[model samples]
Every structure is written in C-alpha cells, then in structure tokens.
Target: MKTQLEELQTQLTKAKQYGTDQETLNKNLLRILKERANAERGIIPKKQHHGYIILCSQQLIKKDNIKYSEAVTAWKTQIQTPYPLNLKSSEIKDQIFKDFVEKNIFIEMEICTDSLDIKTECEVNLQQYLFRANTRTGYWEIELYTTGEITIPLNMQQPKKNATGSCSTFQKDSIKSNVR
Candidate 1:
C-alpha cells in the first residue's frame, strides 16, 4: 500500500513536471485509492476487485516499469527466504496487518505534505521482523517492511460549509478544469 501511494505521487510529480494535466489524474487516483483503503478497513462496502488496473487513468500516470527497479532491488536485498506473506486480496479487511499496531509494539507515524500547492507526502512506518528461516533450519532472519494505506493529511473530502451552505475552497475556474 505504501509503495502504491509512493508510485502514484511520483507519477503525479512527473506529470506536473512535464507540463501534463495532473489535476484530473491526481484526484481520481486519490479517490480510488482512498475508497479501496476504506473498504479494506471495513469503513465502506468491499467490492470484488477484478485485478484490472483502473483503466483510463493509464495514460495519466504511465511510468517506465524499469525506472524504480533499482530501488526495489535494493529493498529486497535485505530479505532472506522470501516466502509468500499471508496477504491476499480476499483478506484486505483482516486485521493481520494491524497486529503490531493493536499490540502497541509498532508506533504509527505520519508524514503529511500540503496539498494546496500540489505537494504531498505520505505516512510511512518501517517495521523490522525476525522470521524463522526455512522451516527446516533452526535459524532466523530479519526483514524490514511496512503495510497499510498512505495517510493524506489534507482532506480531499469536501470541507464543512457554513450555515449559508456555500463552499469556499473551490473556485468556479478550478471546478471547470476538473470537470474535464
């Protein structure tokens, strides 16, 4: 989850840097990610995910698959005997990922960036685990990892309106662009 958000943000950054339209792409992707995370936490109804990457937005965040290969390789180097973790698409709502949090052993951390100017950072917590190496060997290995949704500090949800019921955050021109 953390990795996905990072990739999204990195794509957003590159799009903006190259004078592409980041407005449309960013919000849609954020909302999609937000909803998926909410469903996983049981805050929203879970739907059958068809393994299909959300279509249409592909051109918006198109990335060179090899661009981050080096970083990912470096990250995986620290792991040994990489067996499949107990994670599965069907288990999104399971609290297996929250064990450390519920036990208060792992501290939750948040790194937020202001979205007003299209700058954003996300929550990340690196955890270290001691796993038994190769069920046959009486040895252990250490693995560092993080899982769960990336926290967006700036609320993309509509802001609370005053008694008069008028929104102040978005302007007509801004709304027009997003309509596209």
Candidate 2:
C-alpha cells in the first residue's frame, strides 16, 4: 500500500510541475533515462548547448564531372560565415522549445566570449524549465547546460568582430553593408 501510494504521489508531482509542451517533456524523460545509464557506467556525461547557428557559403558552382569531393567543390566561391553566439528570435525560441520537448534535440552552439576561438568546441543542451523570452527588449534568455569553454587557437578570421560582451550597438563598418 505504501509503495502504491508513493507511486501515485510521484505521478501527481510530475503532473503539477510540467509546463513545457508535451513533446519536450518526452525528451526530458528520455534524457533522464540516458543520464541514469551513464551514471551507472561511471561515465560523466558532457553537456551540449541550447543554441547555435551555421553559415554556409552562398555561391554554388556546377560540376561537369562527378567525383568523391564534387559536393564540396561546388561551393568554391564562399566566405566563411561565423556562427551567431545567441540568436534572439521568437520563431527560433519557439522552435527550439518545441524541438527540445518532443525530441530533446539540442543544437550545437558556442558561448559569446569564445566565438573567435577555433579551439572552442561547444555543444548545447537546453537547461530544463528555464526558457524565457522578452519581446520588448529583444532579449531571449534560455538556460543551457553546456560543456565549459576553453582557450583555442583562432583559425577562422571573423569579418565582423562584435564587442567582447553582448553589445547594443549597430555601428556601420567602413565597408558598406549589402543590406537593403
């Protein structure tokens, strides 16, 4: 009777605290299970981040002959696009929250201070139940469990060097922007 009562209490507790979309809940549950397995194996799990973006080359070249490296050869005319440290979009936040709940899908991301460092390999996991979005200020705060950053050699030179911390400036560069 005590075990049955305890089980019922656990279910009730879960019901009361769950506020995320149903899909994300499923993902969290799965994550918990996996974490438990890792704990048993004595392998400390590393963290992934809440968000990250990828910039691919824009120019595409057609290939006359197919080869093993043909796919990459197509994008010869391309600039190295840097990743956005933190994206502030309602659409992205919504998508991430939903994806996390349903699939526990965590996108790769780097922290703001270490964007230029090539050695910084960042992975992201949305910290459960800490997502927040403020539209007025364009601030989207989401707690992410992450593997801490490390100093790495700067390989890819960034065209746009943002201020060290999150800045509120929109200073134009000497070169005119292509934006309309």
Give the clash count for each candidate. 0, 10
Deviation from native of the Cα of residue 89 in model 1, angstroms:
13
Best by lDDT: 2
List lDDT for all candidates, in order.
0.29, 0.33
Best by TM-score: 2
Clashes of 2: 10
Worst 10 residues of 1 by lDDT: 51-60
lDDT of 1 at 46: 28
In candidate 1 the C-alpha lDDT for residue 125 amounts to: 34
List candidate 1 segments past 4 Å from native.
1-95, 108-133, 137-180
Worst lDDT 10-window in candidate 2: 74-83
Q: What TM-score against the true fold does each predicted structure earn?
A: 0.18, 0.20
- Candidate 1 lDDT by residue in tens digits, 91-159: 332232332244222232231222122244434434333232323321122233333222222221112
Which pairs of residues collide in model 1? none
Tens-place lDDT per residue, model 2, 1-180, is 999999999988888667456768866754554354333323333122222111111222234333445532211111111112244444445554454344323222233222133354444222222334433323343433233321221221121332111212222322222223
